[model samples]
Target chain A: MATTENGPGALEPRPAPPKEQRFSLNAIQELEEIASHYPERKAACLPALWIAQREYGGYLTPAAIQEVADRLGMSYAEVEGVATFYTMYNLRPRGRHHLEVCTCLTCAVMGAYDVVHELERALGIEVGGTTRDGEFTLSEVECLDYCGAATVVQVGDRYFTHVTADNVLNLIEELRQSEEYTPVKLADAIVKLHLPGSSQTGGGSRTGEQIRNNELY
Target chain B: MGIRNLLFEHRDVENIQDIAVYEKHGGYRGLKKAVKMERSAVIEEIKTSGLRGRGGAGFPTGIKWSGIPQNDDKPHYIICNADEGEPGTYKDRELMLKLPHLLVEGMIIAGYALRGTAGYIYIRGEYVEPAWQVRKAIDQAYRAGYLGKNILGVKGFNFDLYIHMGAGSYECGEESALMSSLMGERGQPRLKFPHAPYPTVEGVWKSPTLINNVETFCAAAKILDMGGAEYARLGTERSKGTKIFSVSGHVARPANYEVEMGTPLMELIEAAGGVVGGALKAVIPGGSSVQIVRAEDCPRVNLDYESCQQNGTLLGSGGFMVFNDRTDIVLLMKRTAEFYMHESCGKCTPCREGTRWIYKILDRITSGGGQPGDVELLLDICSQIDGRSYCGLGDAAAWPIVGAIKAFREEFDYWIAHKRSPVGPGHVPPTPEVVNPLLTLVPA
Candidate 1:
C-alpha cells in the first residue's frame, strides 16, 4: 500500500467527468427525508453514500461519490473523505457477499484465524481477495461487538455467531443458496433505516425466517 | 451480589421489543412520571441516584444533565452514543436490541429534562439488526405519543428522536467525534473544554448538546421509575446502579451479565460459567482499554470504579474479557494494539503515528524479532501517546500495553530470549504474517 500525503492510498483527484445521476426518484426522496432529520444538508453525507452504494451496486465508485455529493450539496472530495473514513463503505467493487470475519482480541483467541484460513483455502482467495466467481470476498474485521458469540462473521447486515473453522464451511454453503445478505442488500437496509416508515416496509438484512424465529433480539 | 438485572429484567420476555409488551411490563411510567414533575426535579432525581456515565468514562450523569443551560433560547439536543465499538463490550447492543423501548423512553425523559428539540442515536453501521430494532421502537414511540410534538399533551414541549448510523468508525464513540460524525464530517474528534466549549455549551450544530451512553440513559429511565434514592441503594457510594459487563474471551457462557457495581470480579466469572479450556490466567476487568489483572489480584478487585482504580485499572465500559492459561499475553497485546492501530482516526499525531508504531513493535516481537530494549521502547512510545491526543482513544491504546508490561513483562522477555511464548506452542493469536511488505525493510 502506498502512503500519500493525504493518507493511505488516498483517492487521487481526477478531472470531473460529465455528471450521470444514478439515484432513483425514491433514493432522492429518501436522501431528502434523512437530510431533513438534521439541521443542515451536509449531515446527510453518510446516509447519501449508503444510498449511492446501493444504487451503484455495493461499492462507491468516483461517480457514486459524485452522485452523493451532488445530492447533499457537498463537494465530491468531502463526501469521499466521509466514505473513506468509515470502514463499512466499500470504496471498491466487492464480491456478491463480503464475509467480514472478526479477528480482534476475543475472536483471535477463539480461533478466528483458523476460520479465516478455512475460508481462504475453500474460496482459493486470501483475506483481502475476492473469489473468481464473484461470490465472496473475505476480510478480517475488528470486533463486531458480539464477542459473547465468538468468531462472529458478518455477511451484510446479518451476524453469524459462534462461527468456528468447523462450522464456517456450512455457513458458506448456506450463503451460496441465499441472496439475503449481499452488500447491496446491506446498503438498501441501511438506506431504508433512515426513512421514517421503513420498519413497516421491512427493510434490513435479517431473513424472514430469522425474524420469525425471533433470532435478531 | 451477582446478576442484578434492572434494565435486563424484561430482556428475556417474548416480544419485549414491541411497545405494547414493554408497556405491559410497566414501560413509559418513567416518562409519564417525568412529564408531571418540574424539569429541575427530573435532574434532581438523577442527581440523587448517583448514576455515572456507563460509556467507560464513569462521569456523573446528573451533573451532565444539569450542565445544559436551562430554558435557553437555543434548542438543546440529546445524543446517544450507541456506537458500541470497544472490542470486548457489547452491552449497548443488547440494550438497544431487546429493550429498545427502554432506551427510547430514557432519551425522551432526557429530552424533557433538558428541553431538547431532538435526540439522535448514533448507532454503528455494522449493527444493522440492532438499529432496525431501534427504528421499530422509535416508530412505535411516535405512534404511541412518546416521541414527536407535545408529548403527553404538554403544550410547547416537543422532542423528535431520529437514528443516525455511523459508517463504522470507533473514534465516533467519543462525544465530540460523535457530534462531528453526526454533522456528516470525517469522524475525527474536536478540541475539548478550555480549548472549545463543553458539549453541553456548544455541540452538534453548535447548540447546547448533551451526550450519554445507551446504558446511562436506560438507567436514567429506571432511576425515574424506581425513585432515585431506591436506585442509589443498588451499587457502591460513587458507582450507583447495576453495570452490564459483556464477559467474553475464554468463558463457558460468554454473555452480558448485569451485576451490582460492587460485586466480586470472581463471582461474575462464576456467573459466566467460569473459565473454559484452562485455569483463569488473567482478566481485562473493564474492556481491553483497562489494565490486565493477574489471577492473584482478581479476588481483591471489585467491579466498582474506586475498587478497580485501587487495583490499577478503571472499570472501563465493563467489557470484562477473561483469559485462560493457554492464552499468550504478548500475542494478546499484539492483537489489542492492532485494533487500536486500525481504529485510530488519524486526527492526532500521537494516536495516528503512535498506534502504528506500537503495532509494528508488537508484530515484530511476536514474529521472533524482539530485542532487549524493545519492551522499554514500547513503554516509552505508550507514555508519549497517552494523554497526548485530543480524545481518550490515544490513552486507551496506551493503557493496555503499559499495563501488560506492568503485569506480564516476563512474557515479553520470554518471547525475546527463548523466541517462543512463555505458554508454549499452540498458543492463540496465529503467528503474524508479513501483511505489510514495508515491515520487511525494517531492521530486525
Candidate 2:
C-alpha cells in the first residue's frame, strides 16, 4: 500500500530523516549561512541539498532530502525533485573515492572510451557500479568543464585530465596509497595553482603572458 | 595568423585576482569610461561594435540589450550566464578563474547600460576555485566603488552585484533556464518564442532583464574601451572581434586561445600545439553540440559565426576539440549521444525521450549489434527531435548526431556489420555476447 511516507496523505509531523539526526551543528550553521545568500530561502535549495549530500557521505539519501525540505521550508517532493535532477548529486551511496570519467564528445574522441573500459576492468566494476572493496565507484559523466584536457576523470573534487588506460591506474594507485596527491604529469598540470596576476581573462591579453610574472604581495 | 591575446593574456600571473594587479594591466578602464558615458551611449557603442553573444547562440549582444524596457516600473536585472555546462566548452571557466575583474568590470558596465539596480553572476557549482576567485573580485569591486553604493563615488549611482553558484545543471546555461534557477526554481527553459514575456521584456520576477554570457560581457567592456568602429574592423562582415576557443582533445597543448573571429580553424588547432600523433581527421570547431567538420573540409571553415554556419557547423562557444585519424568516429558519436541524454533536463518529452532513443541505438551499434537501416533510423530520430523540443538542448542533441552520421556513416555501419567495438587498440570485435538492455532494434 502507498503510505504517507511516500505520499502526502500522512497526518503526523514527519519524523526527522537519518541525515537530520546525523547533521552536525557545523553543517546546520553552513546551511543557514548559505541560505542567506539568496533573497528567498527556497533559493538555497541547491546549496542546501549539496550540504546534506556531503554530510551524508557523498550521496543524497531520503533522509537528507527530507532534512533539506524541513530546513528550507519546502515539501519533501520539491526537495527530492531538485536533488535528483543534476548528475553531480548522487542519489545513492558511493564508494570512498567516486571516479567520474568524462565521456562527452571530446573526451570520447580522445579515447575516453578506453579510459572507462580500463577503469571498469581495473576496478572489476562497470560504469555506475561500486568496487567490491568499497574504495571506488566509476561513472561516465558529461563534462568536468575542462575540455582542453579531454577525458577528465574526477576523483571526488579533484579532476584528472588527459587520462589514458596507461596512466589512469597509476593515478588510482596514487590516490589509493599516497598520503598527499602526487599526480601523473597531465593531472599535475590540471592542479597547478592559479597564482596572482596570471589569469585566463583580462586586459586584452590572449597569449596569456601579459601578467605572467608579478609580485606575490 | 599570430596569437591575438586580448582577454586571454596574463591568465597565469600570480595573484591575478587582486584589484591592484588587474589595474596594473589597464583593468577597470572600460568601467571607468562607462560611468562617464550615458547609459544608452554604452548600449549604442556595443551595438556599433557588433559584439555577438559568446554563449553558443551567436545572437547580437547590442540588439539583445536594446530589447530591455527602460521605462518599465519593474526592477531590471542584469544576469551574467557564467553557468557554462556545455561538454567541450570551458572558455567561460578560463575567464572567471583567471580574470575575475574582467567579468566584474563587464557586469558593472552592463549593469550601468541596462540600469539594473542589482546584478548576479550565476556560476556553476562544480567551479569551486572560480567561485572563490569571483567572490574575491566582487568584494574587491565593492571596496573600490566599482560595485555597491555610489559606484565610482558618483552620487545616486548605487549598484550591487552578487555571485550565485548553481547546483550542477547544464540546462541552467540557457537564458530562461538560468532565470528560473536564479529565482529558485528548476533550471528548465521557459518557452518564449511564439509567446509573450521574453526575458528582456519580462524576467526575474516579471521584470526587464539583460542577460549575457561571460565572454560576451567581457568583450563588451573591451569594445567600449576600444572605439566601436575599430573593434568592428577585426572580423568578417557579420561577426566581429576576437573569440576565445578552448581547444582540447588529441592536441599537444589543450589551452584557451582568443583569436580574431575570422581566423581559420586550422590555425587555432596549430596554436593548440597541433593534434597529437596521426593526421587530423575531424574537428568540432565549436563545442561538442555543433555539427562536426570532417578534416578535409576543416581548412575552409573560418572561426566566425556566419562562416561556420555556412559550412554546416557553428562557432559555438569556441570550444575547439580536435580528433586525429586514429580516433573512433562511431564511439565519439555514441559518447556525444550519452551526454545529451544525461543532460536533457526531462522537461520536454521529445528531448528527454528522443535523446534516450538515440543513445539506445548508438549503444546497440557500439555493442556489436547491426541492423541494415539503423543509420537512417538515427537520422529520422534526429529530425523528430531537432525543432520539436521545447528548447535548444534538444536541438543541440540532434545536430551533432545527425552531423556525425552524415559525415561518417561508414564507421557506424562497420561496427554494426562486424559486431566490432571500434574502441581498443585493434579491431576488437566483441568476444563476449554483451547485451545492452537499451538496444532493442533487432528484427527477431
Candidate 3:
C-alpha cells in the first residue's frame, strides 16, 4: 500500500462513521412545508440545508449534509456541492459569534481594512480563525450591500452599520457581553424567515416590535 | 431634478410595512386596477410607462413582461430577483425592509398580468431581517385575499407568493443563476440567448417563467397605481420614471435618493450633502461594475442610461459611490479586484482565472512588485475576460479595472514606478499585513 504524504493535500486520517440523524421533528416538518412551496422536491435543497445547518448547530457536518441529501432525495455529492458553494454555510464549526466585516469597494475606501486589522489585533486571530475562547470568528467579507453604512459588519441576522476602526473594538466589547447574534442564532433566523407566521411566533433575534418599529438596520 | 418620490411617496408613513397601514396609503390599488383590466391592457400600460430594469441592465421592463407567451397553460412562474449583492447597492434591502407590502403588491400585479401560477422572491440569505418583513407581508396578503385563489375576488385569477432566500452567492443575483439556484443547484450562470432559451420561455423546471429585479417589480406596481403615461412623464425620454441611487462613501448624508432619470450626476452628490471628509476625487456612478468618472468629468454625466453610456459608464443598479481626495485609486482598484475574484462563480474559465490574475497583478503592483509592463498586462488580461465569459460577471470584473486604467493611468504608472501609491501613505484601504505569512516568503 502506498504511504500517505505529510503536507498539504495529504490524506491520512479517516473520518469517523456518520452520526445518527440530527433533524428534529420540527426541522423535518419545516423542511417538508418548504418543499411543498416548490414544484419539485429537489427545489427544497437550499432550504433543507438551512434546516440542517440549524439542526446541526450552525455548521454542516458530513452527517448533516447526508441528512439534507436524504431528506431532499438528492445525491450527497450534489447536496455537498451546494453546501460548499455558498459562503454563509459553515462547513466547519465556527466561534459562537461570526463577525463578517464588509471590505468591498465602498467599505474599502471608508477604512474597512482598518476595521479588519483592528478586529484581528483585538481578537489575536487572523481573518479566518476563531478565537481560542470560542467567542468570535473574524473574517473579511465582500460587500454586505449596505454600502450606505460603509464598513458594515454582519453578526447573525443583524447588520451593525457605520463601524469604524475607532468604534470596532467598542462593538467587539458589546458583542462580548451579548448572547444574541450567534452563528446558531443566524441559522435559526434564516430557517425561520422561510416559514410562514414566523414573524408572529417571534423567530430570530429581532422582536415583532422591533420589526414594526422600523428599528432594524 | 431633486428627489421625486413615486415608489417612496408613502415611505415615511408609520407602520407602512403593515397591510392595514399600506392599504391606507393607496397600496394594492394597482393590483385591484390590474386585476380589473384585460391582461393585454395591463401589459400595454407597462409598455406605455417605458420602465427599464433597475437591476444593472437597463432592459425595458414592459418588453420583458410581454415576452412570456400569453394564454399558456404551462404553469407560468414569476421570480422577483431580490438577491441584491452589488457592492454599493442596497435599494432592494430598504424596499423589502420598509415597504414589504409594496413588493408583494408588485409581484401580485405581475402574476395577474402574466397569468402566473405562483411567485418566488429570491432574496439573499444575509437579508434575514428584510425577508422576515416580506414573509409577514405575504402571510398578511394571503389572509386579506390579496393573494391565493381569486385574488381581490377576481374569479379564476389566483396567485401565491413565497420567499426563496439565497445562501450567500453573488452570482445568484444574475437571473439565470438565480433560477438555477432556485431549482436547488449550485449558483452558476447558464448559457444566455442564442445558446439557450430565455428564462421567459423555459425556466424553473422548464415552465415558462418571468424573472425581474425587485425594483422593477415595485416600479410596475407604481406604474399601475398611477397611469402608465403619467409615470412615463417623469423620467428621461428613454429611461423612464425615477431611479433610486444608493449614495454612499465620503458623502455627508449617505442614503437612497430616488430622482428622475436625467438628473445631473453632481446634483445627486449635492443632494447627498456634497462630498465630505475631503474634496471629491471620483464617483462610481453605478455599482462597482460600471466605470468610474473623475470629479472633473462628473459634471458632464447624467444619471440616465443613455447619458451614462455617452460618458463611458453605466447607471448600473444606481450604486452611486463617491470617493474623496484622500483615497488612493490603485488601492481601490485592488480591493475591487479582490471582490470580483472572491465572487466569481468559476463556471467560466475567463472569469475564474482572469479575476485571479487581475487580483494578483493589482496585488503585486500595490505590494512593490510591479514590473514595467504590469499595467499593460492588466489591461490585456481585462480585455480577454471582458466579453469572453459565460456571464456578465467576467465583463463586470473587467470593466472597472479597464475604466480605472483609462481614467487614472498615471496612478497605476506611479505605483508601478515607485512601488507605492501616488496618493502616498495613509490611504483609506491601507496596505494590510500579510495574512498568510508564507506568501511573504515567496520571491518577488
CA lDDT, every model vs. true structure: 0.89, 0.75, 0.88
Which rank order by DockQ, best down to worst?
A: 3, 1, 2
DockQ top scorer: 3
Expressed as tens digits, the lDDT of each residue in B120-168 for candidate 3 is 9999999987888898899899989998997777899988888888889
Number of backbone clashes in candidate 3: 0
Error of 3 at B415 (Å): 0.5
RMSD for all candidates, in order, please: 4.3, 6.1, 3.6
lDDT of candidate 3 at residue B168, scale 0 to 100 = 93
Task: Point out where model 1 deviates above 4 Å.
Answer: A1-13, A204-217, B433-444
User: What TM-score, to 2 decimals, does candidate 3 have?
Assistant: 0.95
Docking class of 1: acceptable
lDDT digits (tens) for residues B1-444 of candidate 1: 678999898888777888898899999999999999999999999999999999999999999999999967998999999999998999999898788899999999999999999999999999898889899989989999988888999988899999998987889999999999999999999999889999999998989999999999999999999999999999887888899999999988998999999999999999999999999999998888999999999999999999999999989998989999999999999989988988888889999999999999987888888889999999999999998998999999999999999999899999998887889878877675523323212211
How big is the positional error of residue A99 in model 3, measured in Å on the Cα after superposition? 0.7
Q: Please give each candidate's TM-score.
A: 0.95, 0.87, 0.95
Off by over 4 Å in 2: A1-33, A55-57, A177-217, B12-14, B416-418, B421-444
lDDT of 1 by residue, A101-199 (tens): 998889989998889888888899877878999999888888899999898999988899889999999999999999654999989888888877789
Q: Could you give candidate 3's per-residue lDDT for residues A14-64 as a string of tens digits?
A: 553375698999988999889999999999999898888888888998999
Better of 2 and 3 by lDDT: 3
